[model samples]
Target: MADVWAKISAVLPGSVDQFPLQFSDTVESSVVEILKRCRQQLYSDSTGTNQTLYPQIVVDFSWEKLNTGTWRHIDKEWRRVYSYGCLFKAAALCHNSPSAEELLQAVRTCDMGLLMGAAILDDILQVIVRILQGEVRKSTKEDADESERTEVKRIKIQCPHAPAIKEELSVPRIKCPSLESFNTNYLLPLKPVILEGIIDHWPALSQRPWSIEYLRSVAGCRTVPVEVGSRYTDEEWSQTLLTFSEFIDRHILNKEDGVKGVGYLAQHQLFDQIPELKEDIRLPDYCCLGEGEEDDITVNAWFGPLGTVSPLHQDPQQNFLAQVVGSKYVRLYSPEDTDKLYPHQSQLLHNTSQVEVENPDTERFPEFSKAPYLECVLRPGEVLFIPVQHWHYIRSLELSFSVSFWWS
Candidate 1:
């Protein structure tokens, strides 16, 4: 425990110094004020009139009060609170006995800070987080990198039976075309195709397959945001944070006992938050074909149980949806079928279609029946390329883990 505290202490000086570098002078001053107030409130023993609210609540209010401002400003303020709160918590651990509650709080605070904090502080805070969680390195960083490069083993993965959907039109499948060929054939033409043999060498597919147990072991205690409800289209749908273990226990494993609501950890840059998991998969070289650099590509993780749905919607960037663990049934419609799809008129849902593809009511949306579409059951180790603005509907056929790379 002393060693753990020492590790955390070493990271604090660097993180504290880097916090004010990226923002304006005004933001830096505000951060100093917040840090001073938070430190005083947290270390205060008396519930006096001067400090009536708890430190955590005060920090949360500071974050929530800035909601109306630009998102950039709000994130800056939020990161200061979380990052300083994390530092204060780590300091407290040095003087007192470390409790599980305190350690968990420190871990969560650092996780929140990383969501929108200075890039310079990221690696420092990440190391602090692992130390507080008592996660030991299996090997030195150098050894781990060398092993990953040389010791990749491809083993057979037993995938569930592909869902039975009569395909009137199927997306074309290409077997690992060269990047130049891919750019000329698919990217230029704006067509959707599934490329096989692209992700065969990923450690996630071979050495460290993303089973429930494997995920639990590596990232069980890490904090992550998850969407709760049947689907995002539902009125009750909302997002919440859950530990990876809790998400699996309540949503994935508990589904057999007939769990009611769905919990999806969707559209999150989980790789940035958990670097250990990021090492298991390499970014596809094809992302270089985009105008932006590889770092500009938006990578998201989608993990959920069977039957979770991403209703028919389109994105603004070209996407590479890589199936890692289980199969998913994907149905796509070209932008030419936009009028036939009956997109929602509301500003919030303008990009989403109102009609559900599988069980569309022909009376209400008769044109949807005539909308020509392509469909496929995407399997593990396959990468599905979706062009910009192409409408896609996806449903998990089994417990699934998928990663998507979106780039312009």
Candidate 2:
């Protein structure tokens, strides 16, 4: 065992490479012969399923057997080493250069017990030396909400109890509006309007969590960044990188927790992150009318649960907010209301209003009541055009996912 350990410790790293667990080395004959010998020695159970600790041992980490290898709500053993490693790898991938020492140094302290526990570890990682690196993309527990799975049509949220007249502030809704027509009326005027039929052709419209089963299969292993806060206004509000699967399991599936905050996949360039999902959407033809290059147009994703809010804020570029799944309540104030909306005193928040649009404090933010704004409950397959510098507040009314295209 000592000799084997010594031999195992001596090989090159990333010959195994990173997630989806790279194995370009396996194609080489010498590597093949070596792995063939490993198979012979580690035989009798290509699956390490035979080595069960009696009573199917559990751990304080809340690691329990859900089926075979999965446990519910356990912290993914993220350590300082992984932070360094991930930073290194992401930088390397960006620059088109990968370093082996950089990868090995990252996992230098990771214990093998975690690796040995993963059932698929031995079967795949047995070039003789198996190092278990867990980048668990989490489970998208689709079974949790049957209501989200059902197809619903034409659900729009109304802003509750406002004295504001609807006519001056009402947003227009149009069907199949062309680039020329949209440019003539809405785009040129910088007016917010909802366009239907733009997103009906998207492949993501038919995907999991929407088509939860297929999403579970393809996106289960993919890592994503998610926002976890009761609301951004809360002191405890923060962001974390998580698996698409775990995001579904905890935030989406385990929704019995009272609505204080939600797991929001907000403002992530998910189409660029999850290319498999990029096929599910297309950029609006009207975006081509922008000053930026078509490829330079920024496409962002917003996936969240009920009551998730963006507060009252503005972005620097023109926005096409496209709804893919569920509904969102959106309110917009033109840049003309900049002073009336009370821009935050801080430079970072200068573009955001101090007033909560849903429940404004007339005494504290007295001027907010006078800010003229357009309001709409954005429904599925609707795209809301938000011109740059427009102060917008967004709240997801259900488990929702949306795409926004931003261009100069």
Candidate 3:
């Protein structure tokens, strides 16, 4: 515990000192004062003022600057401020001897800042996040080990939606075709296909099969943004950060009875954050079919409980949706049928369809009734190729972990 605290305490001072220009004088003075008060609290009998309090307010003010229409072009200063607030907030909580959950929240704050803030702040906080994660893993090791040893049964895969759709409409399937064959038939024609046997060499499929326990042990303490609701297009949809174990307990294990909402860790650049998990997956050789360099490939993770939905949507890049655990029922419609699918008018949701694929209302969207589509049940060890701009909807059939690689 002493060593843990020492590692945690060493994170901020020297690292932050390296980037003198990163923090404005006024910001630095305020942080210095708060940190001074935090150190004072360490020896005081009673808990001193929480230096961690103002960072959230600072974060909020910095966040407000992103409300401008041209947010992509936002001044870098605000991003730096946001990162500064998050990093020191973690430091303050550490000095105050925060609870395990408090430490986790501090890590979450830093992750949010990293996801939305400046690149300069990344090197400063990376060590802090790792140390916090290590402390969390140490605290939860006993419970995690016990839970891992206990085998909990899972419900079988269920494809209760859209039962009447034609089996003939299923996406074309094949074993690992030659690169030339794949490019000639599928890539050039912009066709969707279910590819098999291509990822047999992946450690995720064999040595480190992505069980609930394996994932929990590997990344349970790490904070990730999770989508809460049936689907993001719904009115109640929102995103919040949670540790991987928390997400597994609430969403996967169904640990809390009577909880009605879904929580999904969807479309996150998880490989970039946790490189250990990255070692388990190999970038498909098929990505080389693209004109871009291998570094241009974008990998995202999707994990969720049964019945989580991704509404009918299209992406700009070529995609390989790889199923590592559980299964998914996927439905796809061509870009030629875009008008029939009735996409949302708002610029924000322009890529998403208003009509639900399985339970679409013909009275409201008559054209949707006539839209031709293809479908499949993607299983573990199978990868589904989705051509660019092809509208597709997906629903998990059980507790699932999937990786998607996107390339042009």
215-318 per-residue lDDT for model 2 (tens digits): 54455544566788846766788877655666766676663456345788775555654456777788988888888898888888887766778889999999
lDDT by residue (1-408, candidate 1, tens digit) is 435555655665444333343444534465556566655544444344433233455346545644557765565545555455555544454324345665666667667656644333455667777776553222212132443223211112335567565745888999999999999999999999999999899999899988776787677777898898868999888888888878877887662376458999985669978887899988888888889988788999999878899999999999999999878999999999999999999998999999978899899999999989899999889999999999999998878899999999
Model 1 has an lDDT value of 0.74
> Could you give the C-alpha RMSD of every candidate to the true structure, in order shown?
6.6, 12.8, 4.2
**Residue-by-residue lDDT tens digits, candidate 3, 1-408:** 446546765554444244344355534466445444433433334544756666665677677865555877887777777776676567667665678877778778767766777755346666677787777777775454444345344333344443344668989999999999999999999999999999988999999988877788788877778899989999989888787878888887777677668999985568867767999999999999998999899999999888899999999999999999888889999999999999999999999999988898989999898888899888899999999999999998777789999999
Residue 193 alpha-carbon offset, candidate 1, angstroms: 0.9
TM-score of 1: 0.83
**Lowest-scoring 10 consecutive residues by lDDT in candidate 2?**
53-62
Ten consecutive residues with minimal summed lDDT in candidate 3? Answer: 151-160
Best by lDDT: 3
lDDT of 1 at 102: 56
The lDDT of each candidate is: 0.74, 0.58, 0.79
**Which is better, 1 or 2, measured by lDDT?**
1
lDDT of 1 at 104: 64
Error of 2 at 179 (Å): 1.9
* Model 1: number of backbone collisions: 0
Model 3 C-alpha RMSD to native: 4.2
Question: Higher TM-score: candidate 2 or 3?
Answer: 3
lDDT rank, highest first?
3, 1, 2
Question: Which ranges of candidate 2 are over 4 A from the true structure?
Answer: 1-168, 206-209, 255-260
Model 2 residue 314 CA deviation (Å) reads 0.7
